[model samples]
Structures are given as structure tokens and as C-alpha cells.
Target: MLLHIQFSPEPIPAALPALSLGSETGAFVEFRGFVRGEEGDHTIGGLVYETYQPMAEREITRIAEALVVDHPVQAVRILHRLGPVPVGEAAICLGVAARHRAEAFAFLASFMDRLKKDVPIWKTDTLPAA
Candidate 1:
């Protein structure tokens, strides 16, 4: 399996990288997380994402490796933005390629859940005046 991970200060790309699928590959899935300007009645001005770099990368790698070992996937890609991210901008992107759609969906969901629970990344949101 191919695994790619990047921590970028620049904007996330609009289009994620396409995987080179084998003849048996039949599904591709992606998840994109975007910064929002509001949550219910609260107003968000922006967000600052922080990470323990060495550990963050290691955790991401571990997640991908685990997916390869446990799932029927062909490739996985993850892009996460660090530092300041404005409202409406992309904060994270994930992609998965697999031999079937069900596996791709399952992997994507599980990977995201694991990332949120296990990754050492944190975010501070700038909120408008109350």
C-alpha cells in the first residue's frame, strides 16, 4: 500500500492526488474537513492548529500502516494544515483507495475517528466577541 502524509502551512489543495489503482481496485473515497465560521450561535473568526511534530507524523504513519495491515486498501493519503487557518478553508484531507467501496468507506471513517482520538494535533479557535 502507498501512504502519504504532509503537514503544510499553506492552503490545502482543492483536488487530492489520484491513486494509481490496480486492475482489482474498484473504489476511491475521500474526506475533507473545513474550517467553519460558526458553530450554532458562536462565531469563529479563525483557527490555529498546533502539533507535536515528531509525534504527530509518527502517529499518522502508524495509522496508515495499521490500515494497510488490517484493510483491503491500495493507497492512503492524508494532508493536514498547520498554523493559522481561516474560516471556510480546508483543515484536513484524507483519501483512500480500495478494491471495493465498502472497504474504502469503512477505512475512511475509521481512520478519521482514530486520527481525532489518537493524533497529537490540537486547535485553538478565534471567537468573536460575546
Candidate 2:
């Protein structure tokens, strides 16, 4: 699924139950990234994420499509939260449905790794008072 690049004030859950696949899909893999409370000894009050909308969306879509071609993924959903995000809240969620558990697991991992390195998204941390 293609997603919109926008900011939200709502907290993102660690697990998104709403993102699921049917029985026809033998395996379902989900990846969720949370905001860390600390970064290099700096207390993280929150995170500010920014994305180049057009390029970010395009790159994500391309990655999803490539996963489908390379793996047995039947359906995929990639969701990323923008703006201020607090610790323990989800920053990103990726769901993958495939014919086998192994493929689903591997593809999900690769997707997240690639998205982080390739997608046009940047993050800045808001540090708390030292």
C-alpha cells in the first residue's frame, strides 16, 4: 500500500493489529520502529522527522514493488509517522504477506534496512535539558 507523507500528533502503537493478512497468505511479517529514549547520552525528548514528499513516496513504492518481484510477498504496507514523535511510540510500520514464513521474514527485514538507507527521510532529535 502506498502511504501519504504527513505529520500526526497521535501516538503510534508498537503493533498495528489493523494491518493483517488473510488465511490465503501463509505468512505475515510486521516490523515496527520505536523512538529511543536516548541517543549518544543525550536524553531524547522527541523526534522530528522530515521527508521529501515526492521522492520519499516514490522510493518507498519502488521498494515495495521490488520486494513483490524478488520475494513471494503478496501484499505489503509501509507506514511512517512524521513530525514530533515521543519515546516508545512507533516511528514506522511495515507489513508483508507472503507464501512462506522465511520469505516474509527476510523480505520484511530487507525492506526496513533498504528504506532507512535509501528513502529520502531525515530525522532530528529534540533533546531534553541536561
Highest lDDT: which candidate?
Answer: 1
Go through the candidates in order and give each one's C-alpha lDDT: 0.84, 0.73
Residue-by-residue lDDT tens digits, candidate 2, 4-93:
333345666555653345676787777878888887778877688878878988887788778766676776776778877777778887
Model 1 over residues 13-126: C-alpha lDDT tens digits? 888666657687798888999988886677876688988989988998888778766677888888899988888889999988899888889888889999999999998656
**Pairs clashing in candidate 2?**
none
* Candidate 2 RMSD computed on C-alpha atoms after optimal superposition onto the true structure: 2.7
Name the weakest run of 10 consecutive residues (lDDT summed) in model 1. Answer: 121-130
TM-scores of all models?
Answer: 0.88, 0.83
